[model samples]
Target: MKVAPLPDDEAQRLAALRGYGVLDSEPEADFDELTRFASELCGTPIALVSLVDAGRQWFKSRVGLDAAETPRDVAFCAHAILQRGVFEVEDASADPRFADNPLVAAAPSIRFYAGAPLVNADGFPLGTLCVIDRVPRSLDALQRHGLEVLGRQVIAQLELRRKLADLARARDQALAGVRAKDVFLATMGHELRTPLGGILGLSELLLEGPAGGQDGVADDLRAIQRAGSHLLEVVEDILGLAQLELDQPRLRPRRFDLDELLADVEATVRPLLRGRAVALNVGRSPTPVEADPTRVRQIVYNLVANAIRFTERGSVDVTVAREGDTLAVRVRDTGVGIPREKLALLFRDFSQVHGDHEAELRGTGLGLAISRRYARLMGGDIVAESEPGRGSTFTLTLPLAPAT
Candidate 1:
């Protein structure tokens, strides 16, 4: 018996076949359907979608067959894969290469065989779509063409399977990376907060001590306090963002007067308007809300502070109203308005919209992003409407009751 020799690109062909990840897999209906069609079209009792491996040719799908695989040395599909087109033996018993082969002499007793090479996109033949008969016979031209067409479909399925697996792996990797980043941020934020708090405390004590009567020493100490305070604010923003991203912020909901909450927020940010010509006007009715007052206060404070930062000489207005089951808080600023194109970027982490005139007021840029996250966590959202020179208005809407 003559054993079939390997193809010229045997190493690459084996690599390509393995890359599909089809070896030794259980039968799937898609492949089984094609195998059945091949058997029916070729008028054969046995058909298989075979994949060639290093030592064996495994059947991915088979019809009228009990064994899942055969040795490569005795596999007709192995020899068939060396050709770009179908390889046929009118009678395997008469062909020197397969006449003495165990597969032909015993068991299934193959006498006739025809196979179409399963070629991949890169022109490497992985295996074959084959049909076997117990009696000597030959397939007509039409049957041969059908078999080749089905072989291409098998390659298509393999490509699709590989692509889907690749996409799933990428998705998992991206999620893992995001989780790692959140962990790193949370860790660093905690580590840096301790020293920053110490620096601010020491600077304040020095400013109120004997240094207060000194010439330029007090100013330097005050500057140190300001820088430390700003750094502390940045650290806090980072910590807040990390917590929100990790889904760790627990809302403490209670029934409270939203007007009083707005009043408190107004008082908190009024100090920010001390030196600026911007007018802070808060208009709200006596409305009661059942939600976390602290978080609500944070969101409103962020919006008001953001408006104040942008408006140089105009006014920042805050208004509140109840709409059905939701409450809307709008902060409008008469500063240099954000461009329409830049509006969508307002709520993205580390993203800030900067106009030519507002460049000097650049901040940590986490306020809006964190605020929106907080809003959504409570079943709400924040939206913006603005015209470049006419100024911008930001509206924060939340459910009146905490979402169950």
Candidate 2:
């Protein structure tokens, strides 16, 4: 009998299987106990947790067998992964596939075989929990059930590994973000200090020289003050982003008019829309909402900022309306709309929708994520809808409070 060629992706699967670093590593008694129980329940002479690699089957745990591995070309685990469930062969001697197989006719001379596919967390079959016996015997219904149960335990092990991998990735991403923040901090410090030094030096010169009496000196001082204010706002945003990442307390509830608050937001963002062929349309309403004032302002600012940022040549409309007991504020922009696939990741930290606008835009990618956290803290939520190449709308909804 000729051994069939492995799949085209079999090599990739083998590489990933070995990447787990479990194969050929030191054995733990936890896995050995599992294999021992499987063999005892099946009444088989050998039980092995076999990981099918490209050219070999590596045993995670082996019982009643001295050898650690065998060629995958003759591995039963290879066949087991081809199916979703267990693969059973009561008599390999009669089957054409294993009639002249070296493992069957040579060393093991195995006639009975039972294998339950071990699937990973992502539901990809990696290998098998199998039992081999020289004497041909079929498993009863109860024995088959037992093998299936053991397969779940093997899957649990793989799931644990997957969780560990995910945790490692998250930790790495967080570390990288911290490093970026450090660099930003250094740059901000230099920028801020240079301007502050200039302002201080200019003020001293003006106070001591003839420029102190000149009207232009006052204008220069005002410009210096405005620049300092803008720098402070940037610094505050960085601090707030850091606090939100650390999950610091957010709720500081206060009574505020939803209409007035929204009007203020419109006034603030309208200037950003000027010269872009974008107009601001604010919808008025008589609704009052109870929420954290600072957080609410942040949500409004970030939403409006995001709207203006994406809209190159279209209008950004802000609407505040009362629906049932909820107050909804919508910020809509006709810009480079987000892709449907990426909308799910919009609120995820550090996930920026990379596109044509990416080259012209500079952001820390933490705004939406922070806004969502703040919204949740105030017992409200933010939702988004976007059509690719058309536009996007972001809505923040909060529970409306009765007039007091």
Candidate 3:
């Protein structure tokens, strides 16, 4: 039960090991594949990518071995990293340092051991890429160097993993900030809608009464009414989006005809077209699928309305079809196309098309987000494909039946 002595720079070594944040992490294919390669290349039954920490050696990947970890006192890797080159034990049973070792006397019966220390660019040895066998063995120059090269590759993979994790953390933090802002806006919109509702009521009363006969007063009140209505829509979008974010929606699925749903979406969006040349063409798919018909209409309405809002004089085409066991509803529109740089931001709240923060065609900015959320809750998703200066196509795909 003798423990291995710590390096002189034990504090720095431990810091580097911890910096990777890899100590008890799950096995990844990159590391597993490399170890499998080592086992074959070195002609050994067992291969491991071991990370030596303060009290134990953790195997990030193991091939042909059942153990996940071993005490540092019994880790051959603890001695391997002390050398600049490969450490070899042709016959561990004959060496004083390992003969009495339980690993040698017990199962796994380590008679041969060779390990190449995994060192980072900072010259700190974190662990070893080791191979073990039950019989006395040796490796030629090429096999030894192969282990070293594989060890370096393991370090490279670890560094890549650390970087990718850091990027994921940064992205999650940014998303959290956006969510906080949306929550605030939703709360504020709830508060503002009450006052705006009163304004609309008063304006209507003024237009219907003496203000209607007051000539110019009636015209000005109409403008106020329209503005109030627009603001009210924005506030509603905010409230819906906030509710979706704050709760896991429970979908109520029922049997319904797909064409019947599309009919309503077409009729609702026609008036919003306002005599524009955007023809709303919806294909007939008489598929009797069972789903939440209400949410389906909501998704269709949001997409069609969005298309009608963006296109000034072109046609908006809507199609529905049954692709195998799945249903797809695609909305294609000829409008000012979204740029490649802004495509990723399409479903995010508060993002506008063509990089315009104040585009006249912009809605509450929560329309697409809320629509996508509803679609996903029904076990479906919306995908967009567009080219700049051409047109954009948004496709919604869902299972034919309720997804269990």
Using lDDT, give the best candidate's number. 1
Root-mean-square deviation of each candidate, in angstroms?
Answer: 5.1, 12.9, 10.6
- lDDT for each residue of candidate 2 in 185-239, tens digit (9 for 90 to 100): 6687668767766765666566457765677885576456445444544555566
- Which candidate's TM-score is highest? 1
lDDT of 1 by residue, 25-77 (tens): 77788888999999999999999998888889999999999999999989998
What's the distance in Å from true for residue 254, model 2?
Answer: 32
Off by over 4 Å in 2: 1-31, 82-86, 89-101, 104-111, 119-125, 134-136, 215-219, 222-404
Q: What global local distance difference test value does model 2 have?
A: 0.79
Greater TM-score among 2 and 3 belongs to 3
* TM-score of each candidate structure, all chains considered together: 0.75, 0.50, 0.52
Candidate 1 lands at a TM-score of 0.75
Q: Name the Cα RMSD for model 3.
A: 10.6
Candidate 2: pairs in clash: none
Model 3, runs deviating above 4 Å: 203-404
